[model samples]
Target chain A: MKVRQVSIFLENRSGRLAGVLSEVAKAGVNIRALSLADTSDFGILRLIVDNVDAGVKALKDSGHTVSLTEVLAVEISDRPGGLAETLEALSAADLNVEYMYAFVCRVTEKAVVVFRFEDVDAALAALKAADISVLPANTVYAI
Target chain B: MFNPQAEAMPREELRKLQGERLRSLVARAYERVAFYRAKMDAQGVRPEDIRGIEDIVKLPFTEKSEFRDQYPFGMFAVPMSEIVRIHASSGTTGKPTVVGYTRADIDNWAECAARSLGCGGATAEDTVQVAYGYGLFTGGLGMHYGAEKLGAAALPMSAGNTEKQVMLMKDFGVTVLCCTPSYALQIAEVAEQMGEDVRSFPLKAGFFGAEPWTQGMREHIEERLPLKALDIYGLSEVAGPGVANECLEQDGLHVFEDHFYPEIIDPETGASLPDGEKGELVFTCLTKEGVPLIRYRTRDITLLMNSGPCACGRTSRKMARLMGRTDDMLIIRGINVFPSQVENVLVRIEGVHPQYLIIVDRKGNLDTIEIQVEVTEDLFSDEVKKLEALRDKIHYQIKAMLNVSAKITLVEPKTIERGLGKAKRVLDRRQRI
Candidate 1:
């Protein structure tokens, strides 16, 4: 299943994060699990949100770039072997993950996972073959 | 805000301040540097007659040839042991012109560079990435010391290796960049190609110098980088990159009057022009201990402005935008060309960029000129007729303005390439060294 994610481009400065947070709050978007990527010139704020559309709109309205993508959000166990098993399955299927992140899966005691792979079909097939369930598109997007 | 005290100082006070420093430096020059003393003796310059800065016009002008004649360490005013750092400019016609700095000279250099950066809106809070090729050229180290003096975190990210430069820019978060205007444009192009927005850079501004750039080029850089593009005016001979700098207001570059005294004079007659007159730019290093020059003729074409006071509040004298050169014109064909003229035309040609190559070739003693212009998507995708028409328009404009008729060839966009250090726009393939 695909999870739509939002990435906001920001200059590295004090109070920038505050502006992003303010916009998100005003749009009523819940940032489920977030990650910050940076370079010398700018910072990229990547988030898996409860409402991707609202989050994207909020960032775009604030003059920040919003990139939306269909990504795989697999449900992994909290145990040590969980992540290793998923990674091994993808490797066995000759698939690679371009980027990935972890999120809190409320319905399961296990960890909810979010990932972006260049080849989504191959990755999904590998997960299915390993008998690991990838969450449905709706459930993952509303995370 | 601009400080009005110095610019508003009584003309008599400014004269007196310069006179005192001139007397000391001249006396020191006459005593230490044999070349300087001999040059003065040849011109019959007497110590008591050295009255003031006005008398500086009466003194001999130190040409680059004099430095070449003396070669290595002939221009230094202090002992060799006291010199802390050395820098040299490559010889265009002869031996390399070398400049040295005593410990005190280095300190003054740092202060001048710091002041220039401050004028260009760099603050202690900014992380400065200095990318002016560091080595003997002096541009890189010059900015590095100045950024350090300003108490800013300086990234000594020297020239070339564009990929690494871009990577660092994204990783380290540099806010203020010091480089040539041409290189800044090149970086902006690279960033755009990487699917990154040039405006997304943490950079608030840049101090661009090294080679002559036109106002049109400045506006282009501002449009692409969307930041203040301030001109950094200096030469390796005169303390490098800190002799003057344009503030964010972009009115005129404020010369550091207290340290270096400036004058504009006719290149042919050696007659000094009044304020607001166009002439060759000359400088006298009042506080420079290593190589103190008296009326060092810079050969650059510019104007001087005493125009009331600047918005930045600096009390120093202001210099008008540099147009070109009194000497060393960028000659293409039999007609002489100035880089600024090419820049003026290039900016108006729409799709053509300041990134261009001028090739001057010789065939059986006859000179042939050709311009290699980059073709951006805006120009390349146009019908062949449109592209050819655009090229003809540029050719006609350059010929009309500079009186030089040359062949113009269109290369793929970003293909002529972008340079992030000193922009090498001319290649005289006719002459092989």
Candidate 2:
């Protein structure tokens, strides 16, 4: 299963991140989980939003650099060894994760982790064989 | 003084000598150099018309682009058999401006340099280090031969290798340091880093040139190195680094009117400006044999001082330190960089927009350049590594073209401001210092 994620390029200037957030809010898009990866000159704002298409459109219309990335949303137990077990399974199958971020779903008491993998197909097959539940695109959007 | 007779010649005698040299130089150029002949013919003037320095206004002015038009050796007045040396300007994009020097021309250059060193109070017992780049660039060899001509031990340090530069400066007990003003400051910084006191060295004076530096920078270098910081001005097209130099008076650089005649003209109208009025500095080679130029327009902006006797006993006219350039050319660490050159490199690369901005700054004691290029839609990848690769590609291309390192930044499309009129391409924050 694949999840749609929205990513926007942000220059390392004052109030740029807030400007992107205000644009997303004006479009009535709710961001569920987010992560900011930064360097000295610029940063990338990655968001797992409820409305991916609307968020991307709003950011682009605001003259922001935006892109859509297909990632995996895996549901894991909300326990101490949850991430460790899932990573062990991917390592056993020789799959690599480029980057990953996590958020807890309070109602279900489960951790929802967003992962970007180099070999998505192989990673999906490995998770499927390892019996870890991969959330569907619609399920990730609803969460 | 190196040549007291020429340096301190009376105003009437100096003017008489300049007038005679100007007449002979104009006639030689009109007869041998086709470019000068065509320019003079188009201006409805003849060699006979320029009878003296007072009639120099009738001669046509030469622009830097004329050198590019002539390419490698098209402008040389003498044949290859008589040419002894050649130096070129670091042209970033197209063909470089080439200059040729005959044996006697080189000797005259050395003489000018010797006089320049003498202005800094250097003597035959002094150890001089020439830190300008040697090959192709006129800075290094120009100072090297000048030091030797002055009977001083010339150390051809030739720019870069900061560690070695500092070590030799201390070990050799260098008395005269000839380099770009910025590099002189860099050397002081490196010496400090090595836990060595620059003041403890035998450095008595320095001849700084090949770039426009401010009085504040002069104060910084002098204080740090604890030596007299003298300003020397020259360009490769006009006999290189010995055209003018600051005598110990440190007021303005004294132009060597005996060899290279100086003039100031309005940049826009090309009309001659009065003395003490700021305008573009133009030079006419009075005695160069290989490639004598007639009224060459040096785009550098400065004013002429009154022709009078100086406390240093020199009666030659002086030119104030350069204020600014009339063109968009940027001199980063003694190397010429134009915005169009960077655009040339960007347009040739795939998935890069022509729109760009050049940001030049002085970090610590060195100059740095950062170029921001807009990324096209096709090139903007979600992965940061891909964008970094694109930046690296642009960086390598620029380095290969300009022979200087730059930090290339990939910005989003439409992020760099666009102007309705002439685009603002350069953000130079270094000039403030």
Candidate 3:
């Protein structure tokens, strides 16, 4: 599936976030999923927008520093055993999860998981080899 | 603003004045300067044949390269003992172009410079702090003599030592700051970090030049220092810093037509361009006796507009702000690129530091372009992959923007060499055939 994500470095200043968001919105990039990782001096704002290219362009044209990364979307269970099974499968595949976050699923009673891995294609192949549900970009966007 | 002499003299009267001076200067050059005499004689021309200003165009134009070819003191009209001051260019190769000035030349230079600086509304009561580099660079000495001639309290602060500059600016009540535009921003940044109140400082105006700057940067510097930013334009061989300056109205710079004659010529064709048409700027020193240059091509791309009375009521030709130089354009794989374009790209990228360089080299039979960009310390990461990816994305964006392939290399902040006087931003390695 599609896993294009935009990672932007933004100065910790007033109106900076609004400036980036306004440009992206003007470029018609629908907000898919978003999170901000903060550091002492600045913050790294990541986004999964409907148009990854447009979002990257918007952030760039508006003068915010941006980088693109491919992330894997893994379908995990909403219940306690779901995420544990997924992690165990990844660990068995010799894959390392750099960071991950929870996302809502389109299907009822299920959870969607997004993870940044050391090797994106390898991680996806590992999960698929184990019969773990690896969601596509369309499915993740819908979720 | 228009020059009062050129605008008000009426075309015929201006012609007569220029003719009279042209004949006198030509006759003097023929008699006193052996080089000019030889060149004119080789063409079978006499100074008497150049009777008027129209005849000036007929005479061969002297170039800066000719001075370099002849080396030190070959073009001086007067004897060696009469030359009171000697100035030189800082070029590394060949003999540096040397300029010699007589006591009278220095006086005229100071007067023209003072008149130009006077356009800024600086008075004798004002303390003028010279922030440009001193010694060999004519920018510092040229402005210094001008402010002194104006009877302004001159502080030879010279360059750098930010703390001392700010200290003198505060203690001496400096009213006018003189330096390159880039240095002005650097000083402002230092002042801001030190919690100095720039507005409270006595600086009412800044005479900034020796570098090309954009209108946005001009506004930024004006806002930072809370003073009127004035652009001063000139070169070391022609007469640095005081050749042209913007008036209070700030429409354009008024070339010192009384002392220096300006003509816009097509850089490629060498044909004279009409006023309001952008072209290369060329100047001839009519009054300068020390190292007088005739039709020295400055290669700076700008337009000359003679229409409309300026906010200031002078009659000189107003030169539009320089766009960029034709000579400074970088050729990449048969494509011409200007650093200004790269600057436009970098400045638009948030957190990309202003310190950047364009490296052009010959890779195989083709050319290669690498943009060395500085990463702000705040954005520095420990991970190489993350940084490498960022560099690749920048490379792609610049390639898209300029329509040329480029490599982006990020250097640690403050690693790029800082300039002492004129900043060197472009490094071209292709051997000229």
Candidate 4:
């Protein structure tokens, strides 16, 4: 299962992240999980929002460089080594995780982890074979 | 001294020589060049009208655009047979401002350059490495022949190849360095990176020109390389890189008044200003044969010092170090840049808005320019690689047009500020105290 993640290129100027967040807020989109990759000159703001289409549209209208990325979301037990176990499974299957971020759902005991993998299909198959629950796009959006 | 008698001649005697040369130059230009003849005729000024240097103000000023309108060789006084070499400055469009030199003109160029090197304390026993670019540009060959004319060992190691330049400097004992000041700093950087102490090398002095440098840069170069850094001034239109040079006194550059007569003029009105007043520096090529220029507006902003003998024992007048330009032309790492040139490149590329900002600054004694341009909504894609490719495309086009590298930052549309009147296109932060 693939979840759509929104990534926006932000110049490394002050208040850029806040500006993007305000735009998403105005669009009535709730960000589920967010991560930032930054260099000296620029940064990439990635977010998994409840309303992807509306968030992307709002950001694009605000003159931001936005992109859509397909990522995988997996559910794991909220234990000491929840992320470590899922990562071990992917590593054993030779699936490279480009990046990952996580958040816990309030209604559920399981922690939801988002991952960008080199091969989404292969990673999904490996997680399925390993008996690790891979969340669907709808479940990720609902969270 | 390259020409001891002329270099040390009395002020009145030098002025008399300049008067004779000016009269001869005006007569020759009036007879040979139709452009000069037409300009003089329109002004109702005859060749005989210019009897001395005082009458020089009556001559019409020669603009750089006249060189472009003439194109390849329309300004040459001599025929193609008498021409010995040609050099050109990069033009805004495709056509460059070409300058030709006769055999005697070449000799004069070499002599001037030799005198310039001598001003930097270079002698016959020294080995000078000419690192300025060769071919079509006057820097390389001008310095090369000048070093040879001074009876010094000339290392014709043109521009680039930093490692090799350092190696030759060490192995051959390069006592004199001839190149842009930025490249001198670059050589020092490479030498340090290679675990070689720049101070241990035989670089006793450096003749840095083709670019505007600050006292801070001079201090940095001198401290890093532990050598005397001097500024040399020239242009391709005015007989290359030896029209003037700073002597050992580290004062203003002494103009080779016997050949090239210097004048300060109000850039707005084209009226000659007296010495010691800051104005546009203009030159009249008094001894040139191929292309004898009259009141050629250099666009360089500087002032002429009082004419007298200096402590260095030179009688020629000196020009203060260049402050800036009368126009918007930016000299980045010795290459001339105009805002319109960048605009020209942006206009040709699709999806790029013509509105742009050029930011020029000095980083590590070298000039760096960053051009921020706005792209259309369709061009602002979600793909990072695609956006990077578009940025690279603009970068490559600008590099091809300007012959200088610049960082291209593709911003969102309307990010660059717009003004109601003339849009502020350039922000030069260099030379700011």
Every candidate's lDDT: 0.76, 0.89, 0.75, 0.88
User: Once superposed on the true structure, which residue ranges of model 4 sit more than 4 Å away at CA?
Assistant: A1-9, A12-14, A29-143, B92-94
Colliding residue pairs in candidate 2: none
DockQ, candidate 1, vs. native dimer: 0.01
TM-score of chain A of 1: 0.89
Better of 1 and 3 by lDDT: 1
**Per-residue C-alpha lDDT of model 4 across residues B148-211, encoded as one tens digit per residue:** 9999999999999999999888888889999999999999999999998889887788999999
lDDT of 2 by residue, B300-354 (tens): 9999997567899988999999988999988888998888989888888874546
Interface Cα RMSD of candidate 4? 3.4
TM-score of each: 0.58, 0.92, 0.58, 0.83
Q: Going through the candidates in order, what fraction of the true interface contacts does each contain?
A: 0.00, 0.20, 0.00, 0.17
lDDT of 3 by residue, B312-346 (tens): 77666789888767676554532336677777777
The per-residue C-alpha lDDT of model 1 at residue B262 equals 94
Interface root mean square deviation for model 3, in Å?
A: 7.0
Ranking by DockQ: 2, 4, 3, 1
lDDT of 2: 0.89
Question: How large an RMSD does model 4 have?
Answer: 5.3
